[model samples]
Target: MSATLKWMWVLAVALATGCGKGATPLPTRLVPTRMPTIAPSPTSTEPGSADSGWVVAARGIEVRNLAVAGVVPDTAAPIYAVRLDPALVRLRVRYAPDTPQLLRTWVAAHHPLVAINGGFFTADNQATALIVADGEAHGASYAGFGGMLAASADGRVWIQALREEPYDPAVRLDQAIQSFPMLVYPGGVVAEISDNGQRARRTAVAMDRAGRLLIIVCPTSAFSLQALATWLASSDLEIDRALNFDGGSSSGLFVDVGDVRWQIDSFTTLPSVLLIEPRTS
Candidate 1:
């Protein structure tokens, strides 16, 4: 079937499912217009750096730092989590404290596509899961680049964005293909390496050794994403589903814990990030 037709069918199903009662409206938050403030850029010079990148949060959001590492590698940043075991993954549904309604409204306006479902993943012209999207970023040398989006049968999601700049078309394509196998599942643990030929930028996102849903951004890249995949394939971890999202200047990750939050941005840098922190009853 044609891609357009497939999407149409999916939308039909979503709306159809809401025909009965108990259909909550899609969250009303558009992607903010203001670029988020990203920490100073890291380099591939050190395979082991103390920098986990930046951690920024919107006001009124409470955050508790949980130390958990080893799920990926210490080469990333300081990891955080709500629980240390897979059983605690349910805390994600609790979400963080609320942000200003205006911010939520804004994100929804710019980001028109949002939903919930069993599986989520996306590539060029095709996306499975709740959302399928395209994202990009700029290199230090300054160039246009893009990446993919993938989601799992569970609610876990991953946004695979290119970390290296000065877009190298050949390397970008190679890395995207390599992303398929670079995942640590059950909680969305991922490893992203740039095509710097030296593995200068390496990042992994997962529930962490602590079971917190996280997006770890690092400064390191191998010749290909396959390098990371190869390592993960041999590990004891079992990844369920994964996806890739926009990277580079467009590469962003946001999380909120009660009144605390952390956000990584490429383009839209804000004093703090206003995100969809679900309510806890």
Candidate 2:
């Protein structure tokens, strides 16, 4: 059941149950490409101080590992986050539902600097929500539910909570991916999730107040949705909007950039992935 394509594809990932009302769309605009920014060499050569233990991995990328202990009652893990400046990093999506593979496989085949598991899918490798790669939409959108990490036609990238910002069909997207049960809202507010105390490995995509993208992963299933959202609200990340990607056995992340090297594989193979590459002028 191997699926091939002339170009990479993307679709949204839907939650298993209930939906929410649409709210306001996020407003993280992509900084334009003036002065040949993000290519060859960036304007600033001085790395930021290692405050908060963040390592500047590349010109516009940073990585950090946080030993979160007692952030929530009986919940903790060594949380990982890769921060990227969209002005210097390009986001792309790859789909191969019929040929599900490991995160390493996607990185090896595409040669991206970083990669992570995308949204949710069914047992048959079918997307449960919507994904728009290169203007081609596939799978059904969550509609008035969940949240989306999407780029408009002019290269503006945003993570919108559908409950606050419902999807507008008239808008053309260059790339987009959706996921269920948004965890954080604007101004660092955590969404209250109702679950029966089930926990799994967690992954999330967030936009910081500075408009930087944060790719977060909790490798251990040690925290529930409420706990994770609580930490995000209290953490120093200053997150403006955040959406939860697929969790449990589908969590994974890979990195191979300046001063950063990692390879965290998921418990199961993945049919879709989000890739990051250095933006060229």
Model 2, span 111-150: residue lDDT tens = 9988888887765776667888767888867766689999
Q: Where is model 1 poorest over a 10-residue stretch in terms of lDDT? A: 112-121
Runs in model 1 lying further than 4 Å from the true structure:
1-182, 185-205, 209-211, 219-224, 227-246, 255-263, 266-276
lDDT of 2: 0.70
lDDT of 2 at 259: 48
TM-scores for all candidates? 0.32, 0.80
Superposition error at 2 for model 2 (Å) = 29
Deviation in Å, model 2, residue 99 alpha carbon: 1.3
